[model samples]
Target: MAAPKEIPLDEIQWHDPFEIQRIGGLHSNTVLFYFASSPFFDGTSNNAIVYNQAVHNENMNHLIHTREAFEGRLREMTGLEFMVAQEPAESGPGMGTGVWVIHKQTRRKREPKDEIIVHAAYYLVGDHIYMAPSFSDIVNHTMITITEKLSKCFAIADKARTWSPSTGHGYNTASATTSAKAHALESKGTTPMPNTQESSTSEAKKPTRSAVDSRLAEHSFMIHMQYGGEYMDENPITGKPGEFHLSSTGRKDKMPTLALPSLNTTMVSSSLTQPDKKDAKAGEKTPKTPTGMSKIKRKKSKAGATPTSA
Candidate 1:
């Protein structure tokens, strides 16, 4: 093998991963590629075809779409299970991703540039099922970083010989879900928990938190209110009745206390001792009745009722 040529950074043709649909290149053994880097396009063609991962591929504005379309044709010609990358590396956010694209005709007002269309014939070499992406642009080229990655990929591909299942392409452990979570944590590179038994025990026993579903106290209360719970005490304008302290956000709930300000005492015998008057007031027509007291409140009309007001 000849020495790998160094790719210049500025000469890379950039593409956006978000523009393609499920876009990612596949090994000859038919495994979809995860993006460790981006694609590149210089003025001339080379062994390196740059691309990205299988995320953020709804937009197809560049040559990446063209590459994607070519890969689709490759899949059709090869019968390989493959798609385009949806996104590039984690760094690709906000930053652009390179992709190849296809457009039928420019608007009639603007004269269109020279368009390339691909037609194909299928031939099977070995165990490889060569199919293609059903589009025009074959490969979306991006930057030199991806070009270098592509060169590495080609070298690896060449050393292993054919795009066969034995190459261990499917067994990529670098960016799997659990490993990805671990890798993401590793990249931030914080210190591990203290090695004391209590700390280690606590860390080991801790449950994975629901980051998306977790809510602030107020947010939880608001959600509770949305479902018909009233938070009258939470209003800043109308403070809660008496001694309750506000939350950090200045919200409050009702506070309970035994002592009444007006009475200055608690009712001890209210239910047990005052059954008669309370039952009477409550309109319970009981088994027993008093001779003078009736169920109705008969206003003693100016008759025998003594007036003793000062």
Candidate 2:
């Protein structure tokens, strides 16, 4: 067999992973391709394309929606059968992930089987969406290694990413994004980065209250009167009966107690013990009809007539 001709090192072309490209039609607005890293370091005859997009679009705003559109596009463009390698999983709160794999066989039957696999993933960070796509020969280490790295990189980058609702394109330079976030927290009166020293000093300076002070704190009461509005202090007595208190705002005055006439115990006792004069006058009409009664009456008449007859 003839020795294969060696290609010069200078002729070798390197793929640029940090290329930025703008794509349209998946969403109403354009999707920004922020960064793409390829895993094809060896010079091979496999035609593979790997890229990443930090995207913002109302239609493709979430991880689920983005995955659908992305996978649909890949199938339509590549005309290959693709399977869901990994379903959308939450890497963190308000974060999701998805991965899809594709296999393509060589066109000719006599030629050795050349399998190509395409891997893609997406992330929903804040209101922004990020997607990663990799294309490589379905060799064990090439496609698998790249896909794992891609997911890890996306998860790590989630913390630094932010989205703005007002602007369709929420992405900004690193320095600008940080400054804008800091300004926003300040305006909203939120402590994005709390000061431990100030918090400790304030806590230390607070004096410990006594038990008596704590007990008396809830002693205050509001006094309400029938005729007037309520007041915080106790009600005071006014001079005259049925009169409002001088200090009282508008409350009704207290009613006065009634005094009874004094009673004479001696006069009450004589009146109860004395006999009526009407009964004594009726005694003269009987005239001592019975014997015993007549004797007694005669003796009384004689004594009254004169002492000489005795």
What's each prediction's TM-score?
A: 0.13, 0.16
Best by lDDT: 2
Candidate 2 residue spans exceeding 4 A from truth? 1-36, 40-65, 79-84, 92-310
Residue-wise C-alpha lDDT for candidate 1, range 160-184, written one tens digit per residue: 4422222322333434657777765
lDDT (tens digit, per residue) of candidate 2 on 22-89 = 23222212121221122212222121221122134444334223545554444333323333344345
- The Cα local distance difference test for each model comes to 0.39, 0.41
Worst 10 residues of 2 by lDDT: 27-36
